[model samples]
Target: MANTPHVYVEWRGGTCRVKWWTGEYHENGRKRYESKGGFTDEDTALQHGQDKLYEIRHGINVTNRDGSTPMTQWLDTWIDSISVDHLTLVSYKSLIENHIRPFFKRKSVAEIDVMMFRAFSKKVRSVLKERSADNVIMVFSMVMDDAVKAELRKASPVERKSRRGKYERRVKEKKRPMAIEAVDQLARNTECHLGPSGSSLIWTMAMTGMRPAELYGLRREYCWPAWPASDPDREQREESAERYGADNSMPAIRVEHQVQYVNSKLTLLPPKYQSYRTLVIPDFLASMLARLLASHESDWVFPALEGGSMGSVNFDYRYWRPAADGAEAHDGPRVAKPRPALPAVPSYAGKRLYLLRHGHKEWNDEDGHSRVAVEARQGHELPGVEGVYSNVTPLMERRIMETLQARWIGLQQSRWEGAVKIDSQLFPTG
Candidate 1:
């Protein structure tokens, strides 16, 4: 007599579940039911059972999807069928379109054996050495390897050595941090056009060094204000003037939210690990931020174009690049007509807010906000550790804030004025 099969499903989380089924197996010539498979959710499990029944009846291979296929083709289907965070999707899409698809479009996934993968990897290196394409291959290899473990592939031939060279090169490059003086100069020369708000934002990046994501996510309600502790009696007299009111008030901005694009939706997240902290703010940038806040439309200190959370993509495209050109207009006292010319100062390279955040890590001595803190502020998950940790405290954050504010004002003033010129400073003579 044939035993009837049963499918079991367990809820895993939102729109996800695990599924399995029993199938007949022989143990010492005795027939018995054995668990056959596991799934992510119930609906899929029921569908899986149906598919298995059809496969058994029709003699077809029942699988989630073919693994041995062109890497490009598989990724197209993978991204479509799965739910991924917005920011991750943006990056993953870029990786596929820019690096992966172009490299693997003509290659056949089913026929891609270990030997073929090596050949493909070598070809990638030859085409673009020490570039992001090399890194793409490494990431793709891991994804492919996972498919193999999930029983999606017969095997994967990816080699660790093939990807090791690219990673090693990246590590070596990080040691050569961009010259802080050069970056500071770039900031100073460009401040005039960054606008009061824009200048404050840029300065913030240069000094305390939050990433674009962190900078864009700043809000008015998060600011911190201080009264002179030495003059307590005097502080109360000025307190009324400093307190933020309906029309004007004290200016303070704190670290609270971070901007991240998830599932194609721009959104704000709490400082990674509830890692929100405050800064003392340099007197100058603080003053600038105060002025900027007075002009803001809402509680958001620097709102986006559409009243939604601002994003780094918009920050660079709409603000930074244009402001860079404007700064070049006044770079040093113009001797003659302002002719459009590229600033001898480099654009956002190592000089970006992202790099400034790294500088913050260098100056920060507290337990919670270290280099890892910088990455977290930038909305990036720290390598080998989860996004949030229990150790980050408000005092540590406050110290970081003070460091950032002072750095912003000092670095900008120093850099823009040609204080750190490595080469002969050039200005429009016309």
Candidate 2:
């Protein structure tokens, strides 16, 4: 072959031009172009081009490679490992096919370079927020990685490039934690008016820091009036008891599994790794949970409106918010108009249930309890790389519940200035 400055080879579509510095040539006479500073000379271009093309066609690489695998194949292999209980297959499949596959499809995974990855990430960021883009990228990276593990690609170029520089902030959305005093006010004013179910709902969440899912997912078996039979913390204490001659007291709750509604079926799954652990329950909340459990139906502690499980978001919006609103004495949005009073119905009933969850998280954090404990209790793992594979433990759950109750007590007495003020009716018990 001539030492042509610009390499010319037959690609699937037609004759293609590859820069002298960056091109690949296959035994079948196909040539591919690379984004890097392509070959500066004809000889360099020809040799490198041939090497890449052969490597892509033959799956020959020192470290790892996905050259022989189509990007679609890699994606499917990667997607198989994800537990999509929280997300629907349609949504997951859409993101993979529409958003992810088109960009990387048919490209040799080994050939994906920094520039290509940067462009891919930028495009994803344009569609999703920075944080969401990061997540999408993480999924992509995981998929590509698995492809490499399966000998589909040499390694994930996206992962390598992702580690190189200051990461671009993908999502800018900020969710402000609810104000602590507002929570207290809501808790105090609403406690009495909110029926046992409602009151118990708020109290349990504020104290245990459980996610609405965990709350709804709660089974009668998890709650203990006295103490759990097989609490690891107590077992650890018992070991200490044997060594130091101290009496070991078991924990109050033994949260193991939670019910998740998938495909209209309530499937029992382990809590997020963080939430899987148990925590000690405080005396007050322990008593409350015990009583609440005593009064509950056997299957679900907090039944959804009908037999079907509720979407956590929907439940919070329709039920919890309305319940919170019922505790308020005032009518709709306050007005300075000539009207003597607003409608008899509470003003905030239309609000979503997220307010309560947000409020509870804030109250928990304000006190000395750890975020990990709260996350574990709520079945939310710490976000980022570490959350993917973590599991929950009984002891962790107990600590989370105990910490939550302690925080709830603290919130009852807290009165911070300039906070969102729910009426005194919301926190009636305090």
By lDDT, the best candidate is: 2
Model 1 misplacement above 4 A = 1-77, 80-84, 97-110, 162-191, 224-285, 298-300, 303-353, 365-390, 393-430
User: For residues 89-126, could you state the per-residue lDDT of candidate 1 as single tens digits?
Assistant: 56677777876677678765555677877776777777
Q: Candidate 2's residue-wise lDDT over 1-96, tens digit each?
A: 554444443333333334332234667977534422334444554566556556646755322223545677767766676665454444577678
TM-score for every candidate vs. truth? 0.55, 0.59
Q: Counting only residues 3 or more apart in sequence or on different chains, how many pairs clash (N, Cα, C under 3 Å) in candidate 1?
A: 28
Give lDDT: candidate 2, residue 88. Answer: 45
lDDT of 1 at 57: 57
lDDT of 1 at 385: 45
lDDT for model 1 comes to: 0.53
